[model samples]
Target chain A: MTSDITLILRFLSILGGGAMAGILGSLTGLGGATVLVPLLTLFYGIPIYFATGASLISTIATSAGSASGYTKHKIANIKIGVGLEIATTAGAIVGSLTIVAVHEAHASWIIYVLFGIVLLGSLIPTIQRSSSEEPLKRKPDWTTRIFQLAGEYYDTKLKKKISYEGVRWWLAEIIMFFAGVISGLLGIGSGALKVLGMDWAMNLPMKVTTTTSNFMIGITAATGSSIYWYEGYIQLFIAGATAIGVVIGAYIGSRLLLKITNKNIRWIFFSILSFLGVEMLLEGLDKAKVLVIATTIEEMISIAVAIIMISGLYLKTRRGERAVKAA
Target chain B: MNVPSKQRDIDSITSLILRVGVLSSLSLIIVGVILLFIRGSADGVSISQIASFHSTFNSSYLNPTHIVQGLIAVDPLYFITLGLWVLIFTPITVVFTSMVTFITAGNRLYIAMSLIVLFNLFFAMLAIPSLIHT
Candidate 1:
């Protein structure tokens, strides 16, 4: 009887954790795996392999739940998403296969460090571009024309239609390929990289970038999941709970996203990126024995950095708003 | 300028499929979990045993024959397994439908693009793993 209670409690905890990850993932287009893996492993004491398996399931749930809404609203650009997916899917296959070689080399720490550096580096652009809702218009290039990378969406917050075109399609594709490789190597949805591909390289609006990234994550995750399945990584109870919770959270998050401003969404994304970046960096350092910090201290440092960065950005944005008001 | 009607149709269809797939799988999972709670075990595996962090029993142990047997006997764990299979295939279904949609639209570029992605998915999910095992 006590065992039954314990089981129920564990199930609920997993469900709650999955829901939280789903909300953040759907909101930021990071596919919730970023949050889910850490939460399950650190908080619940689930094994990392099982946590990753559950995280993959949550990613699909978030993508499916939120992408449906985004599609119905015409916020997710299907043409661009499908076109770029060719590179990501191919990259995923390569990355999954490459993991064997990487594990054999015992060089997985490098990937963690590289991933951390990439996340931290991308923050500069995210903060710089936070003030603008849309990118400056540029002349359409051939790649954009050939790929048909332009679309307009009705922005609820703006109460108007926003038409935008993605340029530098080749650059975006290259980035997406790396994104897929990273996803396959790491067993997480590389949503941040996908967002960067579209938002930075392709010059799509944040709203479009996020929703489209969410749309693509499902396909990417689906590719990797089969491998995880065959490897015996998926724990049925954990995955079942996480998938259900993530779907509910993702549904709520997609609704919230439509109502929230792009700047607000960027703030949320920025905070998550900072936290994840520092966590990954510390994890890599600890594993490499380069800087042997205790896990508690490492977490404290990541939280502190995330808090400082988020507050700094908030104050900067407020000051800018005040200046505009005075003007 | 507005989105083309054909494009809109594609979006609606895709969204519908995603919604259906996710919800149906979710329902199946929920039912299975509930059943497990009432039954206290699934397929001779106790709840505690299957729910453990270090549990060795997983998707690897599941096979088509066992899944079919579980479905026939209304095994709770197998229901969950079936639900997972559904969830995993949801996006693959979307990709397939999108390819078909592109074909009907006669959008040559997207048709080729979708076919490439679909093939990649198949290769990664089925071909590569089977080849490696062999």
Candidate 2:
């Protein structure tokens, strides 16, 4: 009887946790895997491997749930997403294989540190572009014409048809390969990297980047999942419960997303990115035993850094808004 | 300018495929969880054991044959596993659909692109894994 009660509590908490991850994942197009993994490992004491398996499952759920909505609304550019998958899928293969070597060498901390730095570094471009609704127009180059890297979507918030052409397709592909590698190695969707590739390198609009990144994530996760399945990383009950919860959360998030502005979405993305970035860096350092800071101090420091960065961006955006008004 | 009708068709179909896949998988998972709650176990494995964080009951032990047998026996765990399998395959199905659509639209570039992507997926999901296992 005691065991039964414990089972019920555990099951319910996992379900609830999954729903929260789904909401944030769909809202920001980060696939929630990054958030879900940490939540499960830190709070529930689930093993990192099982947590990652559940994260991958929930990532697929979030992607499918939200991408369907985005596709119906024509916000996700399928053509561009499909074209880019070639690189990401190939990268996933390489990354998955490389993880075996890393695991053998006990060098997983390198990946953790690298991921942390990349997340923090990507924030610079995000903040720089936050003030603008769309990227500056660039002449369509040869790669764009060949890849058909152009699309138009009706922005619900702006209430206008936004047509954008992606440039530097080769650069985006290179970034996507790295994104896939990160996804495969970490077992997270790595949506931030995909968004960076498209938004920063390809010069696509934020909505298109988010939705298309969401669309692309499902395939990427699927690739990683097959390998995880073989490795026996997936705990079925946990994954199922989380996947169901994430779908519910994603549905709610998709509805909320359609009602919000691009700037609002970027703020949400940035806030999550900052927190996760600092946390990952601290985690890597702690694991490597390079930082002797107490866990509490680390947590406090992460919160402090996130607060400072978010407020800094907020103030910058406010000043930019004021300048635009003055002009 | 409006999106080309051909592109619009592809988008709608992709959305439909994803919607159907997710909803069906969700229903299966929900039913499986409900059944597990009522029964308090599956295939003689108690709920506590199966749901435990460190549970050894995972995808590695269950093959397709085992899943089929479990499904035939109406095991709730198998239902959940089946749902996950559906969820995993949904994106692959979408890719296949898009490839066919591209072929019909006579876009040579996209057909080749889609083919390469599809092949990569197969290589990762099937070819390389099976090779490693053997």
lDDT for each of the candidates?
0.84, 0.84
Q: What lDDT tens digits, residue by residue, belong to model 2 across residues A1-327?
A: 787677777778898999988888888787877678767865687866687788888888889989999999999988889999999999888877776566658776665666578667757766766556677898999988888888899987888999999999999999999989988887778888898899889999988998999999999888888887877779988898799889888899899989977677778777777777787788778878898688788888888999999999899889999998999
Model 1: fraction of the reference interface contacts it also forms: 0.85
TM-score of decoy 1: 0.92
lDDT of 1 by residue, B1-134 (tens): 87889878989999999999999999989999999999999889889988998898887777634778898898998888888878878888888877887788788999999889999998988888677567
Clash pairs for candidate 2: none
Q: TM-scores for chain A, candidates in order?
A: 0.89, 0.92
User: Distance (Å) between predicted and true CA of B103, model 1?
Assistant: 1.7
